[model samples]
Target: MKVELVQLAGRDGDTAHNLARALEAIAACAADTDLVVFPETHLMGFPTRDTIAALAEPLDGPTLQAIAQAARAHDIAIAIGMAERDGEHYYNTTVLMTPQGIALRYRKTHLWASDKGIFTAGDRYATALWKGVRVGMLICFDIEFPESARALGQLGAELIIVTNGNMDPYGPTHRTAIMARAMENQAFAVMVNRVGTGDDGLVFAGGSAVVDPFGNLLCEAGREACRQVMVLDFDRLQAARNDYRYLDERRLTLPGERIEHADGRRELMIPQDSF
Candidate 1:
């Protein structure tokens, strides 16, 4: 599958401008690409509490409708992030729109920084089949937790897409974490992060990239507004899985006893006889 990652700088509190930028990027995507992914909150830059509430829109809002129209016109699947409004509550959501229409909507499960107070956490993880590939969806901080990627891998997701708004001083860390997730899960991982600074003065590091199951970086973008297209090799993915068998050999339960730590002290809890 050929996927395009759009790394762009979003305008703070300007949904209209940001939406236009996103559409322009989508339109500029290479032909024959199966999917295109944009950074988190692509509709509007990550904002303050008041700005978030003000800019949040319903699922059927105009921003998404416009994106869906573009997806249909381009005949490609597009995944982009936005602030979703559902009555009084708002969520950091990623909407995956296919050529037909909206295919999947995933809310950010793990809130980061100010998001904890501005948005409600999502309750479920979602996956969809696109172009014969089992694709899993996750937002920014969700990929930081190993369990998020592992859960999707267990659910038979061969490709995991992370829509992020990660910023400076921690961009390298997030990039390493993404590669680790791909290696451990034996799945292709793609992360699309934004660039430039936000209203809060947070400088986003746009190191958007695609990694193979073997942790090889297929392509990576620097801290600039750009787009990258790469082909995912199913053969390489299968070869990596066959060579490591990490997922197949994983043991969900620890044998005998489990370790515990608290207040700098460690203890072992014995398992029941049923074990």
Candidate 2:
């Protein structure tokens, strides 16, 4: 499938402007592209502790509705990040909208630093089927955890999209993590991060990229705001999985089981349950 990564800078506290920018980025891609991805919290930038709630919107809010309309008009699927509100709680969420309407919504499960106080953690992971390809959805820090990507891999996901708002001092770490997730899962991983500065004084690192199952970088962007399109080879992904067979080789154990070594090292065991 043809995927487009939109790397852009968002104006802090300006949802409307950010939405417009996202729409424009989508419009700039080829009409036949199957999907487009945006950075985390693309609607109002990465919110601060005090501004997160103020910018939070319902799942069916106008911002998402507008994006859905655009997806229909463009004949493509769009995945974007935003602050989601469900009654009294707010979440760092990513909504995937298809030409038909909203297909899947994934809330960030691993809260980063101040985010724990501003947004509630999501308890579940989500995946969607786009033209026969099982696409997993994750937000920002969630991809940093191997279990998050492995869970999706266990669910039969062939590709994972990470909507991130990764910022200063840790750009290299985030990029390496994205590549590692792909290599370890034997699946394709697409990471889209925002650029420029935010209200929290953090300058977002814009190294948006697409990594193949073999940990090869298909395409990547620098720190500047730009649009990147890359073709994902399903055959290559399948070939790598068939050759490496990491998923099939993984050992499973009980939920609370632990393996203790004579060297004083302990490891949590994975349950022997196959999805």
Worst 10 residues of 1 by lDDT: 261-270
Best by TM-score: 2
RMSD of each: 8.4, 7.5
TM-score of each: 0.89, 0.90
lDDT of 1 by residue, 1-275 (tens): 98999998988889999999988988888779899999998896676777777899998988899998999899999999998999888899998899877767788878897797888887666566787787888888888888778767766778899999998888988889899999988899999999998887889999999999988888889999988989888887789877567777988932333222231211222234522
lDDT of 2 by residue, 1-275 (tens): 99999998998789999999988888887978999999998987767777877888998889888998899889999999999989998899898889877777788878899587888887666566778887888888887888988877766678899998898888998889999999988899999998998876888999999999998888889999998989988998778977558888889622434444442223333344522
Residue pairs with clashing backbones, model 2? 253-270, 253-271
Model 1 scores a C-alpha lDDT of 0.83
Give the 10-residue window scoring lowest on summed lDDT in candidate 2.
263-272
